[model samples]
Target chain A: MFEYIVSKYNYWVYIFLMMLGLYGMIGKKNLVKKLIGMNIFQVAIILFYISIGSKVGASIPILTAEDLHGSANPLHYMNPLPHVLMLTAIVVGIATTGVALGIIIMVYNRYKTLAEDEILEIRKKSGV
Target chain B: MKVFALLTVIITGVMLVYGAEDFPKWGDPNQPGSVHVAPRYTQGTYIEAGTPNIVTSVVADYRGYDTMGETTVIFTAGMACILMLRKKKRGEGESNV
Candidate 1:
């Protein structure tokens, strides 16, 4: 029982974080808060991927002299693919957040408010 | 509406948690992720790219095209933000009155 829990505990933590972020994204009224939630969700996913790529006794993915002299064993080196992929994902997330914030600013300027409900009401009144 | 959103999120989370049970343990070396083409990338990175960092090798060597596309996406997004958010100056188009 203990072994099972210990083995999968990381997943449980990520799940909780994912849920919290999901709730914030869906239930929050403010656009900035929703953007924050999206950031949290992306971060949780990145952490989960990174954790999966880690090994118990592996070092960094950089190849050292010892690796060249001996057998090129994968067991000693952590997986590098996930890290590379997540690096791109993080950059994409930052770009997305910046665009999203800009759009939000435009929305606020046009509607004179930031709340979703208020924006909707204004749109309805204006037949937009 | 908030309650409905909460319910949906809870259900999605439960489903995701249940599905995660089938994933390989934290660091099983022989898992499919490590077994497939990843081994080639890890093994050949040094010879193929001469880069000490395997991540850098894979990103810049093996997946160069994808990285280029991603860079383009970032540029496009920046341009979009500027186009949408930049306001016109006060006297730019006012007929000089």
Candidate 2:
């Protein structure tokens, strides 16, 4: 059990972070807190992918001069796919956060509150 | 409601832990993620693109189309934000809600 835990501890840490973000998204009543949780969740996922691409003694995904001339060993460098995918993911996360913040601002302007429950209550009272 | 949320989080955590049991050890070179296409990229990046940085070459060369689409998505998102949040001039179809 200890060996298994030690071997896969990175996954466990990311899972724990994901759960924390999930809890914040689900339990928090404030709209901004929910956004923060969503950002955290995205970051955790990105970290998980980056961790998967790592190798024990590998350098970054840059080819050294020696590697370029000789047969490059895959094990000598980290996987590039996950890093590429995560770059896209990071951009999408930023775009999502920007749009969500914009919507939240619009909500605040109209309803004058950032709490989910209060916004719902205002909607109920207004019959909208 | 908070209790329900906590329960959901715990259940999700448990499920994730269970699923992660079969994952390869950290920094294991032979992990599935490092096999297949990754090896090709690692070995052939310099030959194919003359770029030393495999990640950069993949993103900007091999996957150029994907990055272009990603840029389009971001542009669309920025336009949506501007459309949704920009201030309106008075008496320009403004109404009290």
Candidate 3:
């Protein structure tokens, strides 16, 4: 039933995006596409963590007098863990992207093509 | 061989992500991870480390060595890429010369 399918929507969406990234990584023939897949895969982890931290009926975690002194409302407390972790992950992702792009540019300069098969052929002919 | 590879992916994916029920509920006091004995190093993180978060404490303190290892891995990969992509000398370029 749709209810059953939607019961755990956050995790399901995360898994779906992760699988999509995996498929793109494996099925693509071009280096750029592979890099895109790698990005997607990394972002998918960020999404997974964010989803796990999410709570129904939760509000953002900025403190106000209504929240602190008044009777605490459990329904509106946001999880602060993933917000912290996602910032770290985004920095790491950017560093990896820079490295990957650098390698790709170098690869293209040497081989003059982005396709893995073409690069391999050129390497074979040139004894590289 | 292809079928085996597919099976492995499917099995592992299912095992690791079994949906909301299997994971420890948020703020669940009885969860194994919550009940597990925390290391002594994690205790000081709440105050002296100036980080209220415990997981960050675990990452930058107790498991600080692991972050260093990840940096090393990245450094090694960068070095390997440079080595692989380096241009050959004129003599090397002219292999049949």
Compared with the true structure, model 2 gives a TM-score of 0.96
lDDT of 1 by residue, A1-128 (tens): 78876887888888888998999899999999999999999989998898878877888998887565325688888888889889999999999999999988888877778899998998799896
- Across A1-128, the per-residue lDDT of candidate 2 in tens digits comes to 79888888899899999999999999999999999999999999999999999999998888988988538998888898999999999998999899999989988888899999999999999998
Q: Per-residue lDDT for B1-97 in model 2, tens only?
A: 9999999999999999989988889999998888989988888888888889898889999999999999999999999999888778777645521
Q: Candidate 1 on B1-97: residue-level lDDT in tens?
A: 8999899898989898889878888887776666667667777887788877889989999999989999999999999988877667876744311
Task: Write down the worst ten-residue block by lDDT for model 3 chain A.
Answer: A66-75
Give a tens-digit lDDT track for model 3, residues A12-48. Answer: 7667667667766766779999889888888888987
lDDT, model 2, position A55:
95
Ranking by lDDT: 2, 1, 3
Comparing 2 with 3 on TM-score, the higher-scoring candidate is 2
Candidate closer to the true structure by DockQ (higher is better), 1 or 2: 2
Which residue pairs does candidate 2 place in steric collision? none
TM-score for the A chain of candidate 3 = 0.88
Q: Worst 10-residue stretch by lDDT in candidate 1 chain B?
A: B88-97
- Candidate 3 pairs with clashing backbones: none
Best by TM-score: 2
